[model samples]
Target: MLTALNNPRPAMLAVFMLLGGSVAAAASPTITVSWRDKPPYHYLDNGVPKGFLLERTQAIFAAAGIATRLAPEPQKRIWANFSHGATNYCSFSWYRLPEREAVGQYTLPISIDPPHSVLVSGAALARVKTHATLAALLADQELTLGVVDGVSYGPELDAMIAHSANQMMRRTVDTTSMMRMLSVGRASIMLVDREDWEYVHRHEPILQSTTRLDFPDMPPGLKRYIVCSRDISPLVMDKINQAITATGGAVRSSHGTEEERKAHQRP
Candidate 1:
């Protein structure tokens, strides 16, 4: 099934009876909440949707007293819908990108990822260890970098990749395929989010012949947001932002600078 229904009746009743403000009407058009099949973040378990981000998104909508329909969609399809200005649609956990800003409206960050790590094949591990920074490794023309098509490694790394002269192996595949490619030495190295690396490392055996490496020049963790199409009202966005704040979601401060965010994040 492409869509899963969320029963908002009980929550709606509670909102009307106890929370008692002019929350969105229960009869409002149902917003479609779309997600890709990225496990530990969002995926279907026995036809029932489950994941940290999925649950948080449901909670936010429930708190906002808006009706929503959960839908599992391909990553490319989700972005394509936004580009075409699909109405009443929202997707969770996307990095804020410049080009994407023109297509969709973004809510406050709903989650954050740890810094990206490089997955190096056993054959390339020795060579990978020679580079002190990510820039040097990307400068190596002989080392082929495997990248997932249509995915961004955040603004900083995306900029690096665009300017690098390294041989690139772009695949329209998932992380598992990329990992398998590395294990078989088809690609020398690939960058993966630390969260994704941990999840795949536990559930898949492809990492047996690959090693995860970190570099000092790796960009700071990227903040993920719930992006909705243009038709979603500003009023609704304010409600969503309020719900995010209530659920302990983090937002960039007025200055909106990474340096300030990093300083505040320091332990």
Candidate 2:
């Protein structure tokens, strides 16, 4: 029961309502940016939205003369926001998906994350240290992974999980739960961004146990795109990309490496 309070995921529609007025009313052509409560990435600060991407990009968008508002939503609602009849809605950041691309538009990356790492209990790290790729890691039937429901772990990891035996243990909880599960040795694995790893360590020191294994088959980092509803024009995405680039963000190029391996891409 205590875990419920610590890891609450209130309904997305209810959360968006707490923003005082229609997100559309905040700014003309308001880019209603939706985000999950993933700390170090996106989370609420005193009922106002603030986190790495929201705090960093919102100000930049404002400086670029683009109006913005924040909405906290569950992953499903965030996807729905891009479906038909949606307004100028957009996600704060995401690894673009084919389904999302089919329904809306993706801008050049607005944030960058080091290649996702396999977080684990200390004992689990020793077991997986020699494992280079996700496929190799999952070969051990004794191991299981914790996943955030609906989250994309880039193309390579996602594909690997899909094809692997049913070894994944998914939860609707946020990043905190991923860490909590690792601490208690829930499943021995949690895939997360390095930034996410650092963020959890900073705030949950008393509960933190940071042990990570890299997936050498994947790209060196994840590129975050702002997926906008169909109502947003390419010109708007171009302007958004311009603002993003000014803040050290850019689209990922071909993955360069000195080693030969299966290619797990970002798009």
Candidate 3:
């Protein structure tokens, strides 16, 4: 009788251990992500978050068995929160820089290339016959350039822009307002991502009259990434990268249609 009772106790103990292990494995961590209003890439549609990067990130996290909740906030505030480590938030389609690298860690390449071009009004395009580079475009003494505030143009190019001493304007507001300013002749040229310009043109007909200035080459060393706080576990970064690799290196755009790509490339 004593032997039989001891045998049952051991079996019961093993069952309890197995159940505890299952519970521990099932407790997947949930993380909060921050995003700004960048259309076709990240934005809110009808009060629900939607965009290519947002969707892809969600899919990757889900596949990795990591649950996530997205919180849409202003660009500046989101970065601030992430920087202070007050929030466990990640930002997508971010460019990697040394200064930023110090405070943040990035996943493997999310987008291999970033579309870059000089956007100008139709009237301005007619006046300016040619520009092969951003420097060449800035050579025009009378030309006023607009850039998004808080955006870094990489180290070398950023230094050039800062030293140029040219008449440059910046806005902390949305891209739509920048387009409006250009259309109204408030600025001669606006430096922007080609994808962003196309996104606005397709969705907002108000920018239909704008033209893309042909440059010899795109601004160099531009790539997008999934940025996370430096404090995040290295294991988490590895998991995210694994998920991204499994889905292919590039995140498919929600608005990346064959027709759109072809149309944007047209002369």
Considering every candidate listed, which one attains the maximal TM-score? 1
* lDDT for predicted candidate 3 compared with the true structure: 0.72
Residue-level lDDT tens digits of model 1 in 15-131:
677644443375478999999977677878899998777888899998887889999998999999999889999999899998899999999998877777788899998888888
Which candidate number has the best lDDT? 1
- lDDT against true structure, model 2: 0.70
Query: Which runs of model 1 end up more than 4 angstroms from their true locations?
Result: 1-24, 251-267
Superposition error at 112 for model 3 (Å):
2.4
Which ten residues in a row are the worst by lDDT in model 1? 252-261
Off by over 4 Å in 2: 1-27, 130-133, 251-267
Note the residue pairs that clash in candidate 2: none
Residue 5 error, candidate 3, Å = 25
**TM-score for candidate 3:** 0.82
Return the lDDT, model 1, position 260.
36
Write down the RMSD of all candidates, one decimal each: 9.9, 15.3, 5.2
1 or 3: which has the higher lDDT?
A: 1
Q: What is the C-alpha lDDT of each candidate?
A: 0.83, 0.70, 0.72
Q: Which consecutive 10 residues in model 3 have the weakest lDDT in total?
A: 258-267
